[model samples]
Target: MYTANNIADFFLGRYAAEGKITPMKLIKLVYIAHGWYLGLTGKALIDENPEAWKYGPVIPSVYHSYKHFKNSPIRCEHDSEVTTGSEIIDKFLDRIWKVYGKYTGTQLSAKTHMPGTPWDITWNDLKDRNRSSLQILETDIKEHYQQLASKNANG
Candidate 1:
């Protein structure tokens, strides 16, 4: 298990090296990775909970950490200590980058905002309320992506 910061740092270390990653993109990648981890292993990759923000699912800690970048590409010094020292986790992160890292922040946001997605469900559930935050349940994420994995495996 990793902290959300650990996963965020992992992505920053890999993708931000090019200095082309915005906070929005980084957050989305972290959320996507978390979803896939749950789908693949029935476990969460990070302990921090994600809230369905107007943009998409966001880990508040990570959002604050990188929010300074705003819509600009983030600049950071990579830290190796963020890793969990697990080969399995490293491999899964690599796969996540390979599969989803190529997309722009807008593209990733579109994916997360798709109808019936965890973000979508949470957002819809709370859109009319005066609430400032809506939690995207881990169970919903796991089940949704697990079904996606199943479909991919079958077809």
Candidate 2:
């Protein structure tokens, strides 16, 4: 099981050893990788905010589709040529490391194949997973932000 604290530490350490990376950026990267995986593989997201799909997970395919159709006159390629569709699937385990790079002290892993991502998850599951006190996962994300702020200040 991955706690938010461990995730914060993992991201902070990764960015510290490399270059400047905001927590939001880190989250977005992870979200993108995970999102792309789910969309292509017919898996689901914990949060199906269709808006997010426009930016990350579905962006590359959508881009390819638009280009294929729009440039059909000039370009001599068909849908099959551009559709290495599964390539867009989430090799979540590997890509996480690639985006964040290497880690030395602690070996961190996420259950990308967990029962339901933000989109696929139900209200009951969300309440049970994060404690019913909060209505949504964003609440936990907000708390993580506060914790990151305090940690950065102290260290």
Candidate 3:
């Protein structure tokens, strides 16, 4: 299995190859990729847990790793090879980029915050008590994205 850093590095290398990316967008994209991986393959892409933050779903480790960029676009120093040795994962990451890479950070955040989403459920449940963060359960993400896949298939 890939760790969050490995996945983050993969995305940063891909998206930030020529340009830069904000931490908010990178984290959201990683969260989306993880959810889709769970939905499609019934497996996790990474081992890290995501929290429903006020902004959207966030992987804390990824956030901390790139937090120094603040609102600036994060630039990578070099391309990092995915050492997971899984062609399947490499393909899935490519697919994730093709499918979801077009959206901006705000757009992805909107998608994650949509009604009935895992982040929505978790955020709503915790927002009442003024909580700052709530765990967005993997089960919830899997179920939600599974339904989305089914919907897209049926349509």
Candidate 4:
């Protein structure tokens, strides 16, 4: 597994060259990659779990790293740096970018906040608890994506 920043760097380097990538969009993409990769490989795509924040699931590290950009597009900072030592993982991430790279931050946020999504369930269940953030369980994330994959396969 790679650090969320490593994945962020990869995306920034490869996909955001000519594209606008806000912090929210980058964060959501990383979370999505973690979910699908975990579900399919039964292993983590990132080194950490996401926390359920008001808008949706967030990788705190990536969020903090890019928060300064606010709604602005962050410049790509990666320069051929190695990320996720495995080529298979790199290819899988490429696939994720191919599918979701076009979505705006709001669109990706809406996807993650959809009913029964891990962030939705966790946030709805715990938002009133007076906590700043709640951890979105990896198990729940895995199951949700697994079910999604199964549904897509069946359809």
Candidate 5:
């Protein structure tokens, strides 16, 4: 399994040339990549569990790392020197890029907020209602992504 930063950097590296990767988009992309990796291979792509924030599910480290950039496109000083060091992981990220790379950060954020998404489930299920920091369980994420894969495969 890789750290969330590793995955974040990988996405950053891939999009450095494209100039549309934002903190929000990078967080969603990394989260989606983790879910697909876990759902498909039954292995986590990143070690961190994403928290349900008002905006959506967020990995804290990745969020903090790029928050300084705010709504603008991220141009990190060290941008994109990431390598997951697993051939399968690399191939999988490439696939994710091909599938999701077209959308902007706002578009990706809306996708995460969609009904029945893991972020939506975890965010709404909260009784204590922190609304900004509750962690979305890995099991919930895995099952959700697995269901998506199944639904897509069937249709």
Candidate 6:
């Protein structure tokens, strides 16, 4: 039940060379890692098939990661088919990093740059060979953080 935010908060305090980029990239990496974990553990909520295990190495995991970002709290109201795919990853991470800063009261972005590291990936790199699969990854990350919040509240 290790959540993205949990790992991210810890990483940001430690491994993050630059506070802002560390959490931003870690958030993205968490979703990627979760997708891979789901694939390996046969726990993917995105697809319904045993063969999903095969897609884990690349396709399914990436798609799930993108979906989590798309559904994040910072999601734009304008949902255009255009600029809604991998193009939004940069923006997605930006908004989340800002929120993280607000919550922590830390000047996380003071020394960081925007559009930090291009996830630099395309839909072709994910499943169904479609850009829409990006949504899956975005959704997964959002849920991961939500889980973190819930766990902390209870604990």
Q: Give lDDT per model, in order.
A: 0.86, 0.35, 0.83, 0.89, 0.85, 0.35
The prediction achieving the highest lDDT against the true structure is 4
lDDT measured at residue 69 in model 5 versus the true structure, 0 to 100: 90
Cα lDDT tens digits for candidate 1, 64-137: 98898889998888873446578788888878888888898899999999998998888987756555658888
| Count of steric clashes across candidates, in order | 0, 11, 0, 0, 0, 19
The 10-residue segment of model 2 with minimum total lDDT is 104-113
Q: Candidate 6: where are CA atoms >4 Å away? A: 17-23, 44-134, 137-155
Residue-level lDDT of model 2, residues 83-136, one tens digit each, is 112333223433554744442211112322123434224233544566442222
RMSD of each: 2.5, 16.3, 2.5, 2.2, 2.5, 15.4
Q: Please provide, for model 5 over 56-114, each residue's C-alpha lDDT reduced to its tens digit, 9 standing for 90 to 100.
A: 98999999988999988888544454567877788899898888889888898898899
In model 3, the clashing pairs are: none
How far does residue 63 in candidate 5 sit from its true spot (Å)? 0.4
Those runs of model 2 whose alpha carbons end farther than 4 Å from true positions after fitting are 1-16, 45-93, 96-155
- Candidate 5 lands at a TM-score of 0.90
**What's the lDDT for residue 72 in model 6?**
32
Question: Per-residue alpha-carbon lDDT of model 6 for 51-123, expressed as tens digits?
Answer: 1122221233333433455423322222222221233433443444454433321232221211211121222
What's the C-alpha lDDT at position 31 in model 2? 44
- Clashing residue pairs in candidate 5 are none
Q: Give the TM-scores of the predictions, in the order they appear.
A: 0.90, 0.27, 0.90, 0.92, 0.90, 0.27
TM-score of 3: 0.90
